[model samples]
Target: MTTKTIREIALAWKSDKQRYVKQSTYAAYVLILENHLLPSFGDYDSLSEKLVQEFVLQKLENGLSVKTVKDILIVLKMVMKFGVKNEWMNYCEWDIKYPTSETNKDLEVLTIAHHKKILDFIKENFTFRNLGIYISLTTGLRIGEICGLKWSDIDVCNETITVRRTIERIYMVEGDCKHTELVINTPKTKNSCREIPMNKELLAMVKPLKKVVNNEFYVLTNEEKPTEPRTYRNYYHRLMKRLEIPRLKYHGLRHSFATRCIESNCDYKTVSVLLGHANITTTLNLYVHPNMEQKKRCITKMLKSLRK
Candidate 1:
């Protein structure tokens, strides 16, 4: 067996791993490795759980979010596991911990009035770009998915839309320079490739436009070349500003859709599928908080059961 440094193992692992993952995913892994792992542990002779724990703590102290740190650790573990499998290093179990005082903050969602206001304004003055926002508000499509949507993906007769692909700009580092490229690829998970039923309102808006547009054209641009997410995001921001609505991240549209579904008593599993979540727990965790009325009803039911 031959001993190798972490950097050597990482380079080998990356070369082997690239063939199995999507380009966007491979790019992300490379970015994390170059920015976080290589700088800290590349030259280290050996890896241990204690060393990894300290790395995690240092990353957190430098103002990285817990989730971001965890992502970096995941890449680290993958490379470490690769090294062990190839007999280049020893393996050890790792159980990392974080500060308990740090809690995941509640997700931000639009209020009913704000949601309706945006919808109403779009209805009154509709544009192709505005239609993307409408689709997100109604169907909970992510920015990438919506931007990637094509006219062919919509089934007017069946009133369904297929989420087949997504587009995003990925950052690439070459030596000392950094650049970005827009990539269109299949969604990261199978669950993200889903079909959502279009409401009558959405169908009506899309029907007339679909007749004249090229099937290959993107819904947001109505051309072969689709608008990138960053550009669409800027459009969304300007619309919100002009309407005097409070600024919310583009992802808030998805949260608002899920929240409205839960508010209307939509089943948890069904909402999970509609949102194209990998599992139901994601739906529950992000959107299932009970209000005062729900809590009160639960208590009342408990008291009634006691009487029995």
Candidate 2:
């Protein structure tokens, strides 16, 4: 049996893991291990429920979101399991819990008025960057996916935009994914590699440029090199300020799109597919909050059918 500390096993585990996962995923794991797990538990010979619980509470107190803390715990458990298999550390099935009564995390969304105003502005004063925001609202594209889009991915003849790649600035450390911080890679999952149809307005806006723009150029920049997410986010924030609309995170555009789909009574499965969600349940939980009117309508429909 080996007696290496958690830190030792983690180092070996990371190197081994790099071979199996995407560079972006591997980079994320490394960041978690180094920044959170290593500083807290690396020197320990064995991890315990109490100490891990304390770590969780500390992270929560330090303002990390419950989701972020849970993700960190997931990486911690992965390393522990890897160590157990190698006989470098002991194992425990830790049932970590988070306080449920913390706060209601409401999603940021554009009011219908603000949404229409932004779209109208983009149409009147056209820019490539502004087009990205319009696409997200209409198509539910994640920021990175839109940033990575190329002219060739948009098909004027077919009237579709194919999500092929996503661009992000990945956190990196020694031993892996060291080429560049800014990366362009395949979409988040197999489901993310999807094709979404453009609505008439979006199609009309882009069809004219199809022949004139270089096919290899990124849609956002209309240039060979693409703008990264951080830069794009700044641009979006400036536009929001100019228009005097309440500022929302860039992802709120996708959220707004899905919300509109749900409001239109579009099928959940169709909305999920269009959003490139790996599962339909994700689409439901995020977008399917029924109000009193919707609930009333549902009851009325059910009772009417029963009477018939």
Please state the error at residue 250 of candidate 2 in Å.
Answer: 0.7
- lDDT to native, each model: 0.93, 0.93
Point out where model 1 deviates above 4 Å.
174-177, 303-308
- Candidate 1, 147-212: lDDT as tens digits: 999999999999999999999999876557889999999985999999999999999999998788
What TM-score, over all chains together, does every model reach? Answer: 0.96, 0.96
- lDDT tens string, model 2, 136-210? 999999999999999999999999999999999998888654444998999999999999999999999999999
What residue pairs are clashing in model 2?
none
Worst 10 residues of 2 by lDDT: 171-180
List the candidate 2 regions with Cα displacement exceeding 4 Å.
Answer: 175-180
